[model samples]
Target: MGTLSGNLQRPVIAASAVCIASISSDFRDKFWPNKSSDTCSSLEQANSFSLPNSLNEPKSSWVSKISVSKLSNLSFVTRIRIPVPDINNLIPVSRSSSVSSFLYSSLTSSHALINAYQSAELVKAAKPASYTYDVSSTPSEVLYRWHLPDPKSIDVTGSSDCSSVKSRTVVVLLGWLGAKQKHLNRYAEWYTSRGYHAITFTFPMSKILSYQVGGKAEQDIQLLVNHLADWLEEDGKNLVFHTFSNTGWLTYGVILEKLQRSDSSLMGRIRGCIVDSAPVAAPDPQVWASGFSAAFLKKNSVATKGVTSEQSATIKEGNKTTVEAKPELTETALLVILKKFFEVVLNIPTVNRRLSDVLGLLTSQQPSCPQLYIYSSADRVIPAGSVESFIDGQRRNGREVRACNFISTPHVDHFRNDPKLYSSQLTQFLDYCVLTCCTSS
Candidate 1:
């Protein structure tokens, strides 16, 4: 089914294993939906022998899967031999503000989208730029991973004085549906830079549904939290989380509550939590803020006022009534496209209950340690208010909450939005999660 078109021979351990850079179906589908195969889920869940795709002109019938032997170090790229119609050939006009802000994990996404934005003639276009992270690998990257044993396979030993709990570490990176692969690297780097082990999703998810962003993702995130606790309880190691976007935020809320239910040693190891663009609250408030943000996207940006009331109605009642967000295809031209995928995929009512339950546990019941909330005000996806609202609530409840915001762009492009600014905030945040979480008061 799959063939190793590239290097077939394996080199002995130079670095031994580099975190797999290969783009899986999840990464492909989310970024290049057009280039994706009919079978995306297959590749993400299971290693494909022959990923079915037609590359090169020869045999249209000839399909290929990924080579599992080189799974760890190999990077697989889908080479489209034939010229397919440009799915990314988005509508050639933008109407929002000329400045568009985005989560810039790489120059590829930033330059690509920005240039695309320049030629568009849709509504108003405010094209905010993106920024990338500056740090290279510190000898620190391996140190963190080395310390944390696998969540499912860590060992625990009681200390002589009983003052210390010797356990393996586990950190999970929960990403949203449409998030890019590079962001994962950002995550690994962020955690490693701070001396935290990088634990990828036991389940690597690149493509998630819209509207399903919140509550459902919460289940995935929380599962890891609880599962790791059980993992550490046996091994006597601690658990940490580095969650991204909606998926990660939802998980934080869920796991906190689950841990509060159990007051064992596992719960004690729940030291620090790192949240990026994670919304502890529901998307409705963000939905409300969309009116203002959308207008900011048009050619001539408008505030959410009487003059722009009609636009708001069009977005809310325009297409899918069951869903609050507009369709991704039609979502173009305007900033409506910036709506977080969770808003489109998640059910609001259910997500609400989960969020409320989590908050209640953190406040009314046993409290969690400090949580580092990292966000960008210019984030076009989740509102700045969402971050403010969640952090505010946490502080009020007597939880340790620190918030850092990256302005001038939307979503994940903190690096590209303003690299210098992004770097400064990111390292500081990393230091906080590492030192604060590891050291006991």
Candidate 2:
């Protein structure tokens, strides 16, 4: 029985020696291609002739004391055998040698090889693919839509020179709270029709309610800022910001802050700013409540409805009869509750700090570009008093300012209430900006 066992072991040892030699050769080729294949062949020859002194030592002593550099000088340790089941025949057992373990520990201890592998992985992970916003595709998770003008259908409203100027302009439309891509698309199309690239940005209500100082919303805004910076790198292209409500105004402030920090030169590319129904300097709880209520209730909100009066009058024009009554925002039970809720929420240390930081940037860090404020006295969400005060402050700071108060329109409803007047204001401002930009260049 002992002789039979010895004969079986001899054959197994011989096969193991051959397998170890092949594995060592493969490992050398993979990690150290410069190393000669003769090293592994010598290991196999030494294993067949005489085993190393380390094989006679205890497993713990050799494993603990072995160094990677010493591996090339030593032969295989043949005494250790780990039994592994053969996949083809379950009843039979195969022996795996200690050479694999030695090779693995040696590779792991090699700092240069490990660091090179890690660096390659990091580079592979760090590089982002180039992304261009395609208007034809569905909007991405960023919750913004980009529209490029069509060359064939460009509306040359005036001279050929004006058309050429408009072709190089971009209109950035920042939407109000709870506004969607669909809602902003109307405004976007208005610009696209005039041969201007349009980018409409809106924040989701979920992101607003769960707002954090440097959270997902800020990350998304950073992406837009980066894109804008890249866009400005092209020659002859400029931007016009058309902001709606306090939400849009605050977003614009954030964009301005980012641009100022990254590349202040890009801020010079902004030719004009069209502020619509916005710019409440500080964080007012009531204004926030009103804006949020209008967002939640939409058309049904008291903010959207006009006060009724017994004195109804109609004016007769050449072909149109105009109603004189104007919509007014009134306080309601829901509004009272929302106001109180926001009073507490807005005062939270983090929330207050974040809002104050943005407000500070808006007040002190505006670009030296032409600004147009189109607002309404009857806006329920943003108080006319606040808008006028902010406008006065900007004018006092020596900024080129223009303002038009749509006396009867609701918040951000100037365009929908009277398209002709709104369109006229936009057209004049865009033309002036383009002409000014061209003249300056």
Candidate 3:
């Protein structure tokens, strides 16, 4: 990934803007709104428990050339605990042990959910693979086409070098809904133009249940991650993640299983991940299994017509035509089968976001990769209180996060709201996670 913001707000032709007022009114209106009516009014800076300010930005650290004499106590291992939201369950996720050992032990005392993907077909199915992309493709390939403003619709500019940067040339973009963009062709052109090799990988979206037979999303994740893990192995280059919402659950959790193999050096190259509004937890899976309203099941009964087909049989739960094929179908009934297909298949939850999240903490088989968690008190989806609880939990556990940016934005689209700040914050976080880690090594 490159340092370029890939934001289509100002003309890519223009430079960056230094002064906040110089930024277009549209920019401020979108992200940095006057917080007169904020829900989390207490979001003002509370360093009572915050990461170092220097750590917030990219600080270059070089690989120490220390002699063996300085290697004191190599046997020492550290622990970090990540906070998992519990509905009064109070599950604790620690940072010690391998980071991949993250698991959540419930009062119920079992995690059969993780076993769903542990099958031979699932593992074989998870082998790294690649997808053919049409460079000429436009909105057809973009996941947020409808959400993105006409290129530059969300971005505004002055005359700064938003395109120029001197840090490492890796750019990890967390995509919305697990879709990948030929960012190199569009926003990444600035980095490519400057001779930077920009890499963009698709992230898989995880849901409450695995989508088999009819679940293409999880399959997409397995293949896409397989390809990325292999590529990272071939060329020992570090990269960052630009994750979107719960997709981070699918993106990192699925790879953690494969990365733990002794042969996967690619897993070690993950310098850091950049997440905004990451959903490491999920609602009860039973909610999805038996929670479907009769209306949703009946209206969306257009699952693959072949319940007996092997390819479509995985998701066939007892041939319950409606719910088995497409459980928790949220769309209104008037949509076409194709629209319904897109709604159902494309929205499949190959992995349970909530389950993997708790497991991410408990199953720390590897070192907890450094992360920059950014979210706003303005985030309506995950309450501001969640952020507060998260901060408190992280601090109490002695696991230090590089930084947490408390931006004054509305919701999950932190970057779109305040491109300049969001871009700057993200760039800094990437630098710290990657360049710093590289330097430290």
On lDDT, the candidate that comes out on top is 2
Alpha carbon lDDT of each predicted model: 0.41, 0.64, 0.36
Decreasing TM-score order of the candidates = 2, 1, 3
TM-scores of all models?
0.45, 0.63, 0.42
Better of 2 and 3 by TM-score: 2
Give candidate 2 regions above 4 Å deviation.
1-142, 152-159, 306-331, 437-441
- Tens-place lDDT per residue, model 1, 1-441, is 001111222431222243333322234333344545442233122321221132233333121122212111111111111111122222211233321111111222222222122212101112101111122121112101112222222222222221122223446665543343444656555544443455555223311221242444445555445334434533445666666666555445566666665654455666567777657464454443343243334323322111123433443443322223342443343444434533542335554555567656544543365577777544455666778887887788888777776543445445555567666765565446444433544
Candidate 3 deviant stretches above 4 angstroms = 1-134, 138-170, 178-210, 213-215, 261-264, 280-367, 391-399, 405-407, 437-441
Q: Model 3, 379: alpha-carbon shift in Å?
A: 0.8
The sequence of per-residue lDDT tens digits that candidate 2 reaches over residues 1-441 is 223234456655676588667765554333333334332223222222211334334463233344433221111111222121111111111233554454334323332121222212211222211111232111122356656564444533334555556666778999999898878888987887776778888887756765667877898788678656655655766889999999999999889989998998998999999999998999888999889888988987767754222211111112112433322444476688888978877887777888889899888778888899998665667877788899999989998889987766778888988899999998888767766544455
Tell me the deviation in Å of residue 412 in model 3.
Answer: 2.5
TM-score of 1: 0.45
Q: Give the per-residue lDDT of model 3 (tens digit) for 1-441.
A: 011112322533242343223443343243333536341113111101211223223231111122211121111101211121111222232344421122212211111111111111111222201111112111113222101111221112322222112122344454534235642234343333332234444432222123343245445555445434433432434455555554444455555564554345565676665556654344423212221222134323332112233423432233323323342344323233434433443334442343445345523443355666676543333444454555455545654454454434433455555567765775576556544533454
Question: Between 2 and 3, whose lDDT is larger?
Answer: 2
Instruction: Kindly give the stretch of ten consecutive residues in candidate 2 with the minimal lDDT sum.
Output: 84-93
